[model samples]
Every structure is written in C-alpha cells, then in structure tokens.
Target: MPKTLDDELHTAGAGASGRRERAASVPRVAWLIGPALVAGVAYLDPGNVASNMTAGAQYGYLLVWVVVLGNVMAWLIQYLSAKLGIVTGRSLPEVLGARITNRWGRRAYWLQAELVAMATDLAEVIGGAVALNLLFGVPLLWGGLITGTVSIALLVLQSRRGPRTFEFVIMGLLAIIAIGFTVGVFIAPPDPGGLLAGLVPRFADTNSVLLAASILGATIMPHAIYAHSALTRDRFATRRGGPGARRDSGDPTRRIAWHGFGISRPADEPAPAPGTSTEVPTGVLVRATRWDVSIAMAIAGTVNLCILLLAAVNLAGVEGTDSLEGAYAALGVALGPVVATLFAVGLLASGLASTSVGAYAGAEIMHGLLHVRVPLILRRLVTLIPALAILWLGFDPTLSLVLSQVVLSFGIPFALVPLVVLTAKVGVLGQWRNHWATTAAGVGASVFLIVLNGVLLWLVFTGA
Candidate 1:
C-alpha cells in the first residue's frame, strides 16, 4: 500500500526524536538554514559581483532596482525548485528526463544545459583568477590554472567530507562575503534619496535594459535552478511512501539539534505519537521550505545590493572601473586598502564556493538530461578548459565575465520553461502543485525572461 502524506512526513520526522528533545531547549528554524544557504550561493557568485559592480559603476543607483527585481525573481524560482525536490523526491533534471519521452528532445536539452554550465563555470573561473591577480600579483593565465586546481581540491574535499560538511564550508564562505559587503556599505554609503528612488523602476534606455537582463541572468542562474532541487532532495533520503519510510541516516550538520520543522505548529506543540496519523499537513513543510529560501535569499539580495551601492558610491566616475580589479584599485584609492582587500577577498570567496556549486549543478544537468553519469572530476575538467582557453586568447577578464552572463541570459528559457511546466502539472505535484496565483506568477516571470532574451538577441544582431 502507498503511504499517505501524513505517513511520509511522520516517518521523515522520526529523525527528530533527539532533535525534538533538544528543540525543547532551542529553536528549529535555524536547522533549515544550510540547504538554503547552499542554494543562495547561486545568487552571490562571481557573476553577480561582476554584474552588480558594473551596474553600480556605470549607472550608479539607477540600476539598483534591477538588482532588487532580479533577486525577487530568483527567490520565487528557487522556492519552487526546492518545493519540487521536497514533494517529488527527485531533482528537476531527473524529473525533466523522465518526462522527455523523445530521445532527441532529451539530447537537445542536454546540449543547451551543458553550454549553460560552461558559461557558468567561465564566469566563476574568471572571477577567481581575477581575484588572484588582484591580491597576489598572479598572471591571469596562471591564475586561471590555479583557480581550476583549487576548485578541484575543494570538490575533492566535499566528497571526502559529505554534504553536511560541504554545506558548512559554503556557509562559512558566505559569512565572509556578508561581512565584507556590510563593511563596504559602512565605508561608502549610497545617497539615501537616490537609492530609494532607484527602487521606483524605470529603465533609462536600451543599454539599461540590457544590463538589467544581464543582472537577471547573473542572479537567477540556470545551474542554480538545476542544483537547488538536488540539494533539497539530498536533504531527505526518502520522498514519501517509497522505501524505508524512515529519516535519512546522513548526519545533519547543524550547530543546534533541529527538533523539527513544523511551521504550522506553535513552538510548544507536542510531537505527534509514533505510527499515529499526525494532523500536521504537508503544507507545513512547504511553508517551512519557503521560510528557509526567504532568509537565504534575503541575505544574498542584501549583499548584491551592497555591491551595487558600493560601486555607485566609490567607482561611479572612476575610469577603468568596469573590471573587478580596476574597481578594487579605485576603492583602495578612494577609501583605503582594507576596504579594497575586503572586496577582493569577497570576490575570491564567491569564486571558489560558487565554482564548486556550479560543478555540482553541471553533474546534475548531465546526469538528468542525458542519463549519463560522467565522473564529477571529468565534468569539472571539461568546464575548466573553456575558461583556460578564454584566458589564453587574451580576452579581458571583466568583459568576459559580463559576456558570459549575457550568454546565460540566452539560456534561461531552456530551464525556466520546463520548470514552470512541471511545477504546474497536477499529475506530478498533486496537492502541492502550483496554485492559480503561483501559476500566473510563474508563467509571467517565464514570459518576461523570454521576451527580455529576445530583445537582447535582437539588439546584439541589429546593432540598434
């Protein structure tokens, strides 16, 4: 017999026994922070640093609204992605692969997703290499190679340590980024009136629209769209009624014992008796997931906002500030070396951690779309080669990062279209399928992105 929703949730919550006892002492919201933080890395990567910095340096706070809009869209999409994993017990790629009955369609999707992954890695590697060049005087080509090597080492570390350990590492790096940017905002605050006005939302011209699109691509990354589901799926070893019906044995890494994630229940709510149907609804879990995504994205959005604000304040009129390195130097001269170093350090941290996350997403994309499991190491190497070639060809690193994000914008439809389709399908999601409001929002966001990409491509070709 198939397990009911209550059966699946109760079985999953069984892992909370010790957690429940401990929760009697502390809070549970803190437990859900890790997976969302991992997902949030997608928004705070080197691509975002490049795009947000460019927006601030070029247009000042005029483009701040774009960053805000991009992050809001990202959080919505990421929430759906995580909920999909939680409800279906499968990642988005795995779901898409199952649904794409035609072999040719799967292959085509796989090709586009691979290209997207490469674009993502290109930005991350360039950011890492640029950071190395800025801080240590390493040459770009050599820095590229070192960046690749260090990324591999981090991947190896993750495999050895398991997912929870890996997540803690990412969270630590995210903290560094948060601290650096917070200090930056203190040093170079944006004009309060102008910053508030930027939130009013009107593009000044065509170039502003293009930059906004790039920022959207950078914030709502395709790889992240693929990876979040996998991350959440891994958080629970079982879906609902399938197998052992027990919580995963994987040691959850949290500072405090997570008693339970019952958003619908009061803090003092008693645990449901074992083997009894708990009145706790699946909606409770869903709400809890959104809370996690909200907290994580809120932090990420703030960081991105700070990046744009810093650039607007310090590098708005500075020549040659288009690149991350130039921005660092300008900040140093305008503020101090410590502020400059913080920016470089934040970039480096973003580069390293997001590269690792990007690699994980690439693996998911390959395995999901193609059903072919390439070794993770081989996948990382495959993506690394293109970044190396870009450096070897002497492309400007900052410009390359910006162009890579633009390429990512072009690839968004492949992921977004399918994501919207699957989440709305009642057959797949059952009670958790998107409500009408969510469906409308998802479709609207998807259409908006597609139209934006269309306009961008037309602009590029016609030189309008």
Candidate 2:
C-alpha cells in the first residue's frame, strides 16, 4: 500500500526521533523545541502590528497592560493545547470530530472554524501587501497577489521538505521580524515613568477599552491554538516502536507510545512492576515543551511590547499615525528612513511567515474536522480571494486588520472552551490531565476574554 500523508509525517517524526536517540550527548530538550515556535508566529501576525501600533499611537502607553495580560493568558492557553495533543496522540479538532458523531453538527462547527481561519488569512495577506507597497511602491492589489504567491511557495516548502526544514526557514524570518521591530525602541527609548504606569491596568475610556480588546484579540489567536496541537502531534506522536511497528503481544500498552518520547500508553496496558524505573519519557518531552512554549512566548511578548513602545515614544499624539502606512511615514520623520525601512521589512517577513502558518492551520482544521483533504493550491486560492478582493475594493488595510482580529477574539471561546474541558477530563489525558490550578487558570482566561469581547460590543453598539 502507498504511504498516506500521516504515514509520511509519522515516518519523518520517527526518523528525527532515531537521530535524537543516536546523539544522546546532546540535550533531548533541544531536539523538542520547535513546534511551539512555529505556532508562535501566529501571535506576531500583521493584525498584531496594527492593533498594538494603533493602541500606542492613539492611547500612548495606557494599554500596555492589555498586551502583557494577553501574552500571559496565551502562555497558559497554548500550553494546554499542546498538552492535549501530546497526551492523546491527537489534535483537538480530531478529538472533537470523533466525539461529535452528528454529521450536520460537525459540519456546523467546521463552518465557524473555517471562518476564523479565513479571517486570519485576511489580516496576513493585507499586512504583506501594505509592507510591499511601503518597501517597493507596489500597488496594493498587486502586492497582495505577490504576498499570496510567496506564501504558496512557503506552503510548498512545508509539504515537500517536511516540517523540520520549514521550521528553520520560519525561524530565520522570525529573526528578521524581531530585529526589524525592536531596534527602534533602543534608538528612542520610551519614558520609564509612563511605561511603568501603563502596567497598572487602568483604562482611560471607551476608546482605550476598544483598543485593549483589539490587542487581546490579536495576541491570543484561535488559529494558533488549533495549529500548535497539530504541529506537536505531527512532531511527536507515533506507535511505540516506530511508525509501523507492531505489538509483540495482544497487550495494548505495548501497542501505543509517542515515537521518540514514550508519552502515551494504551488503555489496556498493564502497569510496570514496582521495581522498574517509574519515569516515563513523557516527562522529558513535557518539560522540554514548557521550555519551548516559554521561549516562544517570551520572544513574542517582547517583540509585541517593542512595537507598542516604538509607537508610544515616536508617534504618540502625532497626527496621521493611525494606519500602518501613516505609521511608516511617521517613523521616517521622527527616527530615520533606516528605521522606517526596517519596519516595512519586518512587516513583510511577518506577513510571509504568518500567512503560511495560517494556511497550514486552516488545512488542519478541514482535515481534522471534516475528514477530507483539499489540494494545497485550491485551499490557498480560496482563502486568498477574499483578501485580494478587499484590496481591490480599496478598504483601509489597517482597519480591516484590526476588525479581523476582533473576529478572531470571538472565535476564541469555541476553541478554548473545548480545550479546557478535554484537558481537564481524566478520560482524555489519563495521568496527564490538567491539574485543578491549570484548569482554573484556563477557565479564568476564557471568561475574561469573553467578557472583554462583550464589553467591546456594548460600547460600540450603545455609542458609549
């Protein structure tokens, strides 16, 4: 029989595992630090740039608390998502797909998830177009087309080269993004007193509240939550011995294990004798994942803060800095053309890296939920059309980016609520189930996000 995609992925994962075991002198944790970094790209997407930059330019440092709070919540949320995949050997969508037996009900859920993915692609494509126009004077529509094409190339890299090579490429772009966004903060430092005050968590008014919601929306992305699980599953999950290894006996415990990191045990497996080493390989990878998630989140959080601080120090109260192009022009006037050019370069990198990841997440959503696979070219073209049409219609890119994030914020509960519930359930994760404290934190974060979105709607609708 021909190998399926899953078989290929499992084989690749197992090969990586074999290589890791052979090189025992190196830290195993080092080998396990990649999936979260790929998912972290979603946090630094163009919607994030628009929301954080707008907040800083319009409200100064007043909403810094929002950005910080969102990252903190994101750490917990993403860890839970990855944990679900690690423990169950399945992505959240796949788990849900199997459990929700009703066909129409499954289809309905897929629709909403599909919409969230489309919204993510919209922000990414528009951001790329804006970057191209700023850097090379390309027309927005043409720039958007270029961005989509490049992203298609990236998807090809992921498919043909397997994920490890793709991770290296994305990480390279991540370095460019980090340098591009943060160098300005060092050149023109933010006020110490104002920056400290922004951490106190008080809102100035309805407008500040609106910006806060946008920041939260951008920071804690739904697609990132979905993608992290699948990424980890692809990297870590496999049969006990290897991809096609068979059980020596009828015992189920010997039948299942996460290749490389012996995480999962089949439900029917017997317990080891008391004298045997009680430690499972799951702990090693889980600990490594903590380091992975922490490092990724720290980098994402810092870059995001630098973006806000860059605007607060250089563009606050400056007229016409509300949009990205305006912000680019303002950065040139205040700092220099060098700083402005770097910002555009970073934006371009962000757009290219993130849109590719977003497309991967969308593909996972479809395959996991609907149990169907579409050609990558067709999937890319379908999602690319709405973004290109928006550019052709001449809608303001920055505003569209911000609104797309709000749409993401609304989709958060659907992904998050299920994650918390499943991770808390002993049936789903067995010994690896979430501790009460972790579940409480997840619940609190989900509630906080839900309430903030409600307040945003109320203020907008009531004209407060």
RMSD of 1: 7.2
**lDDT values for all models:** 0.79, 0.84
**lDDT assessment of candidate 1:** 0.79
lDDT of 2 by residue, 341-375 (tens): 99999999999999999999998899889999898
Q: Estimate each model's TM-score.
A: 0.86, 0.87
Residue-level error in angstroms, candidate 1, position 396: 0.3
Name the TM-score of candidate 1.
Answer: 0.86
Q: What is the lDDT of residue 161 in candidate 1?
A: 62
Tally clashes: model 2.
0
lDDT tens digits by residue: candidate 1, 1-464: 96644343444455445332112222233544567789788788888888889989999889888888888888889988887876676788998998899999999888988998999999999998998889999988898888888878878877776566788889999998888766878976779998999898877777877788889889888889899888876654332342112222122221111223422122244544443212322444466688889988999999999999999998998999988888998989998999899889888888888999999999998888788898888889888999999989999888888888888887887888888888888777776788888878888888988988888778778887
Error of 1 at 41 (Å): 0.6
List per-candidate RMSD values in Å.
7.2, 8.1
